[model samples]
Target: MKKTYVLDTNVLLQDPQAIFTFDEHEVVIPAIVLEEVDSKKRNMDELGRNARETSRIIDRFREAGELYKGVPLPNGGKFRIELNHRSFSKLEEIFLERTNDNRILAVALNLHLEAKKENKEVVLVSKDILMRVKADALGLKAEDFLNERAVQEDSIYDGFQEWEVGEEQLNEFYREGRLQIPEDKKKMVYPNEFIVMKNSINPSQSALGIVRSNQQVIEKCWYQEENAWGISPRNAQQIMAFELLFRQDIQLITMVGKAGTGKTLLALATGLMQVEDLGLYKKMLVARPIVPLGNDIGYLPGEKEEKLKPWMQPIYDNLEFLFDVKKSEDLDKILSGIGSIQVEALTYIRGRSIPEQLIFIDEAQNLTKHEVKTILTRVGEGSKVILLGDPQQIDHPYLDEFNNGLIHVVEKFKDYSLSGHVKLLKGERSSLAQLSADLL
Candidate 1:
């Protein structure tokens, strides 16, 4: 049945095109939401950009028809600005504060009351957890906006699938370096998705390889060497990641894992291998989103590079381990001397064309879908981009494990031959680190 979905401000900020996603349902944007969007339209960050985008989108819809009354959406739904329900008829006693959230709640409550007379349903959609809770307390149906979420509980894509096969088929895969997938099993796998063919009888027997060309064939893993730049794959998942990273054909690779899972280290090693060792690219461009954990220390007083030093320390630590640099000055000297390999700050990475480079984006879970799109769109010809992050460690208030950019890329590009993803398990940083990742 068709229902009314009143959008919260954060929902539109998280995804500017959110209005069109409520297929065949009423999409109501509270007048307060417009005010909130207007206030953010002039800032210099992604939120500002989204605010402007939302404004333009709503304005374009206005050109078709009056938004105050209701405009017909292409998805066979109604879109409108709820200017009439701004009164505090429902929330006067409960949520006395006239804050934006309460105002939105009041609007949704008024709409819900009105809809009941017509036997309709009104749902308030928000990205904010507390807002949803309060809306529920106010006796309004609430939902989290799910249009941009890439991962679902219990069904997160791990980039690999296990297929039970006959012993003969498994042996054939190992012998011929490839196995032809039967028509019945082909639909289970996507292109470039890794498949583990285990003997149906022998649970101990398995051959790991990647699906290719519409899951018609499974090719053997690509990496022949044991180590890249003195770093070896600690387990099978890392090996799979190495295969994807080393493959020149796979231009985009996403590595998602926990804290000590070595996602960043592996990307850096492969990037160095391709850029410095093999000269496959002109430069190795390493970067990460500058998301601070816990309480922020405010701004630092220094030049751009100095200011970025703390935020990029984790990247440096991995690089130091890879290079065996004992002194910070020595590391700096080495980085400066090797002009071909550079650690870039994501803050300055915008609007720049990066060509013929091996790109590694760490802490990518903090990025929004739009931010990820912007970064990936900047990748020029002859470049390979690796996005590495743990979705569980997202620091952005508006992002979660389900909706962050890394997982978004992993889910969106899995079917494409140009992209490959591996969710690395078994952290190899140390026993203590692994324990902390698992327990703490």
Candidate 2:
């Protein structure tokens, strides 16, 4: 049976090509969806970029057929814009407050009624929680645009593990500085897990084990260069980070952290130390989305780098600390030497192949899953891609803590040896920085 999907404005704004995602199912773009897109066409951030892209996509079809009528999709589906005449009538009664939410809901309700006549399923997709609630009240099937559920913010994993070891085992590990495990530690252990050993009888001999993925056997070379930026791998979170950074096997590292947790700083320091200092990689590259939190950078005069300086300043700050450059001019010299360290926007990253570089994407939490994949696919051989960001502080309105690319990458790649993740907990920025992060 074919399903009919009615997209809200938020859905299109979140992903302009969502019409093609249904995979042979009919997609309905309520007329109001276009109105919302047109209203935001002048936006300068992700929302506006999506609006213009959606307009172009719809315009391509308009050239072939009438948009109000129906156009055949390339992937065995039909797309149409539903103009709700009856919804316009009921708008006053249901949408007495004249809110945008009400108007969008009216479009869905109108589609639901028409779907009932044909005995077809009509599903409305949106990111707004309240819109789905309204659809449920109207007895219509509605869901989040991304089809991703939210995980409790507190329940987000810190990537740490604790284990109670035998008293003799603790003695052996502490005395010999390492211990071998004979049995499988599956349920009690996670891939790339960091374990803290507490003696069942003796408490003073507590030790740590950075578990290797795919097996439980303790390797001899497990604890090399554990201190990263003065933070040791004493807990699971730090161990997870070590597993990603120190390994020659994994090519991708994705980490999530709240404010003051050192996601960007750690990634930059590790990349610089490994690439330039340690001679592990040839060059270091850092990039981020320049999307504004509350405002947009519209029509800025001068070149791209100057316009991008405001957002890329954070990257330079990390580079300054890594190079130990006290003076501003000294840091500029380093940046100039490594022309390989390209500070680029996500837009320019598309349709390019990058090879043999340690690429760090700061503030990755603001990007959508599609955008992240686009950037990742650009990576060539002998390269490591590190994504670091806090999903909670995401500037993109359409994305949330779960559905954003940062979390999606972490969850999807936890099982793969080619990827690793660490959820940093301790904030080492400063006393005041930690307090503000906790209190505010």
Candidate 3:
């Protein structure tokens, strides 16, 4: 049976075209949602962009007929906007104030009554847990907006296991620098599971193995360096990050970190080494969202690149520090080498197929799942895409730790044979940097 879904304001703000996601199911937009959108239209940011886009979408439907009555959508659903005051008949006595949250709840309560009268299942979908609670108090069927949130975080496995192996097994693996187990041995491993082989007799020798398949031990490397780029992978959790970044087979890598984890430096250096030394990829492409962390770049003047100069400066600083170049012009020449390195913005990334290249997306925590999908689908053969950002320091206000696309991809891909992850523990920046991170 086709169900009716009443969308909350936060749902639309999270994704402007969320209505198109529900196939063949009737989508209802309350009038309060429009008012909220209008209020956000003047503001600048992702929310503002979504608000304007939502307005355009609603106006297109208005061409067919009034929003009060349902209009047919391109995909197989009907879209309608509700503005009736009678929706609050039951709750007006208690919620007489015109507060935005109360008004939205009123619209949802009204929809629930109408759906009951017509004997149709009506559910109000929202990202706001409080809104869902309010609907439940009013005796309405309500649920969370699943399109933006993760399935569950409690069950997120780290893709590794610990076991004890015989002394003979350890010597065999060390001599060969790899281990191949029987088909029955596969039962003990997950897709990307890592095994730490501790000597059954000596109790000292141990080796980490990343299970690529039934018998194959995926390529593994060990870094004796205490920390690289102000980050250290110490425990099993940190080891995952090191294994993923050093592997040549797993071409695409995405890492989510807080401020001082050194994600950007690691990604940049890996891209450089891959493109320049290893000859694995043809070129290195570095790009970011151009989203301001604290201040806007609009006040700056000149052409597009000039306007972006301030925002892109941090990336250039990383490159300059990596290459040990002091002059700005010298660094530009290095980047211009037969297009060895291309620093770009997301605006030009669309509609371009990237092949034989290493692409690094810094600050990926701000991107939505749909946007991340678009970027990943554009990757051509022999290309690697690395997304590096911190889930805690997300510049986008709407994106939380679990809900961001970077985390979602990491969680979803942990079970895949081709994917691996690491959470950096020790910060190598400096004593001051580490202390600041802890305090601030």
Candidate 4:
């Protein structure tokens, strides 16, 4: 059965390649969607980039045939553009407002009626929850655009697992600091995944190890009580994070946790230590997406660094806490003395190859998978990149816990030996803050 899918403006903006995702199914684009996309094309952000890309994709299809009539897509389905001159009388009866959403709905309604004559199904694909609700109220089938969702929230990889083992095996693991995973458990572990081997008879006897899939063994974790830049791990997950962060073998590390779980602090501390103390890298580069909390305050008045001060204040705060500098003047002196740390916005990180640097991208949950790909591809030789964020605190309109770039990288790289991930569960900031995070 051939189904007709009417796409909302957000679907294309969220993913420019969405039109190709529906294999062998008719994809309908409303004229109102093009208007909305055009309105965002002039903005200077990810939305604007996606809007332009969407236009390019649509334009490329013009060589095949007229979009208004229909064009044969590569997937054996048809691509169409529905003009808004159609009658909206049916939709006006339900939704009186003349908003763009209503106009898009009117296009879908017209398509639905025409498809019903041929006994075909017409579905609306959108990322807007309210739009889907209104679509169902109008007796239309609607679904979220989930082609890029790689993992579900509940099924996300926690980077660690527990296995029951014989007492002899457990004791051997503790003594030798390495144990071969039984053939039955080999399929259950991933490269760099943490494991807790407990004695089957005595559950209290356990040993922690990380899977070395290439070596076919589980080795002891590289966790010591030593501090990195005056910051020490306070929990089991934090210890695992340090093991991943300070390792030269791991090129990519992702830390997911709540606000107070020390994700950014630990990353910054380790980056400073690696670049400054150990001279492992040339510099420590920190960057983050500029997604504002509420409405943006518009442009500021200053040069690049001065303009970035407000957005990078949180990064500076973490540095100040690490440096133990209270006065702004003193903090400037200390940072100047170090002369190897550079904090910039994610916008400027594109199109530049960064070599021999320790890069920390905070607030990565606010980025899309495409944006993260761009950032990662810029890493040159001998460079290590760390992405840290709280998936629960995303500010991106189109991103969620499962689809954000941080989680996307974590899940995609779990099987690779050069990547490591840790999800911090406990909040060690303060009792009050922990309670607020739990209750609120």
lDDT order of candidates, top first: 4, 1, 2, 3
What tens digits encode model 3's per-residue C-alpha lDDT throughout 214-261? 435632445423354344554554566666666767766767655666
lDDT winner among the candidates? Answer: 4
Per-model TM against the reference: 0.91, 0.77, 0.73, 0.95
List where candidate 2 sits over 4 angstroms from the true fold: 1-6, 15-29, 35-81, 93-100, 110-124, 130-142, 146-158, 172-184, 187-190, 202-204, 220-236, 292-298, 337-340
Instruction: Write one digit per residue (lDDT tens) for candidate 2, span 303-327.
Output: 8777777878888887777777898
**Per-residue lDDT of 21 in model 2:** 84
What's model 4's lDDT at 352? 96
Order the candidate numbers by TM-score, best to worst.
Answer: 4, 1, 2, 3
Model 3 reaches what TM-score against the true structure? 0.73
- In candidate 3, stretches whose alpha carbon ends up further than 4 angstroms from where it belongs are 1-5, 13-28, 34-81, 86-100, 109-124, 129-143, 155-159, 164-168, 181-193, 199-204, 213-243, 292-299, 325-339, 411-419, 431-440
Tens digits of per-residue lDDT for model 4, 271-305: 88888888999999998788822223347776777
What does each candidate score in C-alpha RMSD?
2.9, 4.9, 5.4, 2.2
Model 4 residue 143 lDDT score: 97
The reply for model 1, stretches above 4 Å from the true place, is 61-67, 84-89, 151-154, 292-299
lDDT of each: 0.86, 0.75, 0.74, 0.87
